[model samples]
Each structure stands twice: as C-alpha cells, then as structure tokens.
Target: MPQSNTPVRDRLEEILARLDARRDRERAYVKLYTESARAEADAADRRRQGGATLGPLDGKVVSIKDLFDVAGEPTLAGSIIRRNAPPATKDALVVKRLRDAGAVILGKTHMTEFAFTAVGLNPHYPVPGNATDENLIPGGSSSGAGVSAVEDTCDIAIGSDTGGSIRIPAALNGIVGFKPTASRIPLDGAFPLSPSLDSVGPLARTVTDCMLADAVMAGDPMASVVARPIAGLRIGVPQGRLLNDLAPEIAKAFADSLDRLARAGARIIDCRIDDLMERLWGATRIGSIAGLEASRIHADWLSDDAALADERVKGPLRRRLAVPDEAVAALLETRRALAVEMDERLSPYDLLALPTTPIAAVPIASVETDANEYDRVEGLLLRNCQVANQFDLTAITLPMPGQTRPAGLMLMGRNGADRMVMEAALSLEALLRNS
Candidate 1:
C-alpha cells in the first residue's frame, strides 16, 4: 500500500506508512492481522472525503498490543503457550472505541510473553527494531507497541502499563507514555499480567498523541487545554535517596532538564518525601498485588499449559507463587496509607519530577538470555515509574531528546488527580521545547 497523500492524517498516517515499509524489511509481525484494518482505513478515508469526520484522530492507524483482543484475532501476547488459543469473539472495549472514533486497527504488535518482564525480548517471536539503536533492548512488555510508534508504523500504539511496561519501552524508544490512575481505563478484554498494576495507556511520538490515546482508552471525550505556562509552577525535585541511585548519563540529563525548567520560570523546589525508600521497598516486599492477581487469572493455563510457557517468563511468574497472603494484606494497607502520605506531600506542589528510568536501553542480547541481566533491566526500567503505580498515582514521561542517552522528565501527581498531572505535563512539555 502506498502512503496517504492527505497531510491531515499527520502522525497517525506517517506511522502506518512506515510500518508497512518496515514489515517488508525487518519481518516484525507474527500474525500481521490487518485484513480488517485496511478496510477500516479505506472506509475512514471515504468519510473524510464525504465531509464526515469523527474527531482529530479520525482515519488514523493505531496498533494494539497483542494482549488486547481485536474481535477475530487471537491474543498471543508474545507467548507460545496460547499459540492455539481461540480467536476473540469480540473486540476489547478500547479496541471497539478506537474503531468507533475512526481509527483503523493496524493489527497486533508484539510484546514480552504474558508481559512478565520490562525488557521487550520475546523468545517466541522476532524482536522488533528499537528505532534509535538496532541492537538495544526495546523495553518491554509493550516492546512492539513502542516499536510500531517509534518507527512511524502507527501514530498511536496502545499498551498496558504494569510496572512500567508502557513507559519503559516508550522512554527507551523516545516516545510519550502516560500511566494513568489504575482504575481509570477498563481492562475488560485484555490478557492479565498483574491486574492490580495493569493500566493500559499508549506510546506515541508526542504528548498530544499520548493524550488522544489516553482519552479513547479511558472512554472520555477528547478535550484540549491550552498549554499552561510553567512560570511560577511549583515543581519538586526529590534528592537524598530517591535520586541518589542513577547512572551518570541519566543524572546529568536530569540535572540539565531541571536547570532548563527553572530558567523557563518554573518554581523548582528541593524536597524529600518521608519514607521514600521504605515505602517503595515495602511495596515490592508485599509482592505486587498485580502479580498475584495475574497468577489467579491465569491459574488454569499455568497449571495445564506450564510446559509451553516461555522459560524467561516463568521466573517472574514463579515469584507470584511466593506472595504470602499476609504480605498481600499488608501491601493493600500500605497502599491506602501511602496514598494519604503522598497526598499530603504533593499538596504543596503542582507536580514532583524524576527521571523516568535511570539508564538508557541496555543491549537486547544480554537482556534476553541471562536471567540476572534481565533482572537488572527490569529494576532500572521500572525503578522511577513503578513508584507512581504502587501508590495508584498518575504520571507522564516527557522525552528529553538532547541527551546522549535518551531520557525523560517525569511528572507525578496524587491519586485521582490525573487531569492536573496531564496539565502540568503539557506545560512542562512546552517548557522543555523552549528550553
């Protein structure tokens, strides 16, 4: 198929064109389930020419992470275990919404098996190119979603964020990723990884793209707010322990970003939230509730189809077996307490800033084969962002393109205050561009 001549499609169409080209070059898709997608896109084009339009995203091509159901396609989720799983009889809620809004479903993108890991290395399928660097890890479990967007194959790539699955890949691949309040988006028809932590969002080229995807996924109307200036905005930067553990390149880029934001008139404040490390450690020790829920959700498959599971995915899946009942209870209590704690802390500021990930993309080869290396990648990948998920807060990662290794300036807000966080993010995005 030739690229669209209509410039109105912008980011969405450009990506679909590139995706088509790359599929021929790198052989990325396992199913390439797009027979319906082409028909949908053509229908959208006819609507446009006939003076009918859905919204700003009308007629754009979108790629769903394989974990999501697309009516007739199987939800592979980059696993061999469900290779013979029956096709979905209906589209996932988010998928149906996109179709209603004029988005052409561009089939499913690949990911880590059952989305167990942060690095996007799937043994069951070929690894998609990381766009910036061919050899580096794409940052998973949303690996191909980010790949599809970064390579311009899809304007918006939907992904579920469970411990940084969406943001990690987006950060590594230089795209915008939003991890919204956990319960905001419906997880009705998607495959479960850690249900408690799995909030689906998108990886896109710009903040606008992320916002558009977020609206559709949350089933909210798309509304645009003018980018509020960052001048006099209270933005806190935590130091001491939380910011102490970072790679030199990441630290330098973070420091530079702060200086730039401050110069652009943001009220950059130095502060430390009490029990920062202790709270995070407690959350981990409590055995991620999502992990346990994932196990429960997939109990039948895990028991009957255990042998067919990917070896790399099994290690993380096993950890769920060890989540003590008492620990799960304790974690739930801590989540409530921590929410109160964070609310008190963030009450004084518009947003808290942090580096999305401490290091850039690691090599794909090492991350795929060695379990220890996989752990390292997971740790660094989810370190900063997962904190927001644990507390049920909202956060966004804004790309910092000038850095040697691509990094993101993260903005975090209190639970249920996603709108405020996104407003601050949009302001910060403008501040970053000017600076």
Candidate 2:
C-alpha cells in the first residue's frame, strides 16, 4: 500500500551506501553488482524522466538468491565448495527476464547451502539475522531473501521455494511471499534443489509487487490484478494437525484473522484433506521429493569428502541417495495421484488458509547449541508451508495482523490457480490491514 517516488539511481546509491557503512552486510548479500547496477539504475532514471518507463518493475530495486546464475559467475548457492566451479555461460532464464523488464539487479543474497535447510542457519555463511530482532533466526534457506525483502534497500527479493524457502523467510520477516504453481515460472540456469518441487517466486512488502514480479518472470502479458471482493468469498481452513501447537500469539492472530474475514461476509468453511496429506507423507516416507532428487543433482559431490559443504545439506542427500530406485518410482507415482485428489478436494474454495509457521522466529542461540532443538524448530517452521509444495498447489504468505513478533497467514489455491491465490491474498491483505 506504500509507494516511493525516489529515483532508481538515488535508491541504489542509498542502499550501496548502507552496505558500505555496515560490516554485517555479508549476512544479507553474498555479492553486490555495484557497477552494472548503477548503470541500470541510471538508465531506469533516464526512462522515468523521459516518461518511457518499461513497466511496473522498471527501476525497482531487486535481489536474487545466490542459486540463480549471472553471466560469467558460478552460482555458489551459499556454499564454498562451488568457488572453483566454472562460471555460468549465460544468465539464468529468470534473471534474464527480470533484467529485460528493467529491474535493477542488486546482486545475489545468501541462502542455505544447496537450499537444503529450512531454519536459516548455514554454517557456510554469516547469518542474516531476523529483520526485526538480531538474536532470532531469519528463516531459511532463503534467509537473506527474507531479510532483504523487509529492508528498504531492496524492493523485491526473488527466492526459490522447494519446501518453503520463500514463504518461510517472508513470514518470519513479516512480508508478502508468493509461491506459484511449480511450472508457472521456468527454472532454467537456477541451481537445482529438487526438480519436482522447485519453484521461483518473489517476496515483497506488498501483494502488488509480488504479482508484478511473478508476471514478469512468468512472461505473462503485463496486467493489473484487482483484489477480489471478500463478500461471498469462500475460504477453506484445513482442520487438522496443521493448526496444532499454536504459539499463543500465532493462534490468536490466526483466529482473529478468520473472525475478521467472517465478519466481512466471507464464508469460512472447515475443509478436510487430512487423509490426502497423510497419504502424501506416507508415500514420501521412503524419501522426501526434494531430498531424493537433490541427491541425484549433487551426485558428483556426494561421493566426495568435501569439508566445506554443509553436512546438513550433504548428509540427508547422501541418505536419500541410498533409497532404492523402485521406491523413488513409487513415490513419484503416488505423488501424482494425490496431487490430483487434493486439487479436487480444494476446488470448492477460493483458497486454503492456515498459519505459515507454527511458531514465530526462535532464538538462534538455542537452535545453534542443540542439535535436537534445531530439528524440532525446523520441522515446525516447515510443516505448514510445505503442504503447498508437496500437494501441487500455489500459496502466498501475508504478515499476520497484530502480531507482536512476525508471523504469516498463508492462503493456498489449487495448482495453477496462481492468479486466484494472488487475488485472494490482495483482498485479505487489505481486510487485515484495515481491521
């Protein structure tokens, strides 16, 4: 809902200045495209001054997660092992699209090594602490993406969501994060985490920015997305363990949001897909869709004793590499069936709603000191949002209204229902803000 009239060059300089002033900027960005960014910003400024702006994204300050390729640079993907890897021959497809649309690239932000972890800790890089609090976890593997999305230096931070990489950080940082249908945005040239689950999305302070970035990256014709009317809107709240173990604040915030929507004449129905979810989980018991595919993607390194690689990433992937080939086949077959069933179940509603994370950001010290504590925290954070990735649905996370610490209210739609999900989120964002 907020707009800035500052020139793109000025904005870029201010961000660059702030980076120069701060010693901890490595926590947010692994690289900064200083010269090229300035050039682009100046061009954007010239266009604005001449009334020939490219489109909504023109002149917008944007940041990409480290997994994406820039011409002639190896995408480190938040790990040191790749420093010796050959530089990319060309820009990643999404990067090319963003650049073509006139977005000023601010360089690559930090992420979990290989985007394997969900709670933001990467032994390989400096922690990009939570935006609101220094001690709390920033949420991973798009940890920097989350922090950058909230920081004024970046207007939109692009991140990949295999299993909540985008939404988790966005929720923790209290920004809007959109994860579209898996095939909605092309993934060429981006480092692979899980080919089956990987998706590219944008995190911003407003739904409109997310919609705009998504459109450009998706190569859809530029168009405006109006907020759908809440009156008679059908929102389905999944009734099950997804709503369990609410941090008192998260529970109250979710309940209050549902109440507000109901008061606004939106019909909130209790939707059940517990069986479908359980079956999906059961099938993946051989291995998760991500870990299994990632093992193959990183097979070359899995055999090496690379000390710099985060075991958190390599360890699980190593284990998944051992899963029987037949099991992998069965998992994929079952997943396809369940995805179709889940779609039918959710067809009656405009969107499926729930808390993005079961808990808000937790103390980094606690998670870092204890292995058990880290696993517990990561599971809870990834639990709610992973459903969308696993079940072939698209989702968005909006900052929960009136929360002391940041949290998110997620609305998921049937797979390929990206526009519907964005529209509902736009309307819901307004309702929550006004209330």
Best by lDDT: 2
Model 2 clash number? 0
Q: What tens digits encode model 1's per-residue C-alpha lDDT throughout 11-94?
A: 335555665665666534455545566677777777878888887667777888888886766787777777688999998998
Whole-model Cα lDDT per candidate? 0.77, 0.91
Q: What is candidate 2's lDDT per residue for 287-355, written digit by digit as tens?
A: 899999989888888888855688778889989999988889889889989998998898799888899
Candidate 1, pairs of clashing residues: 15-152, 15-153, 120-140, 194-290
Runs in model 2 with CA error above 4 Å?
A: 1-4
Deviation in angstroms for 344 in model 2? 1.0
Candidate 2 residue-wise lDDT at 196: 88
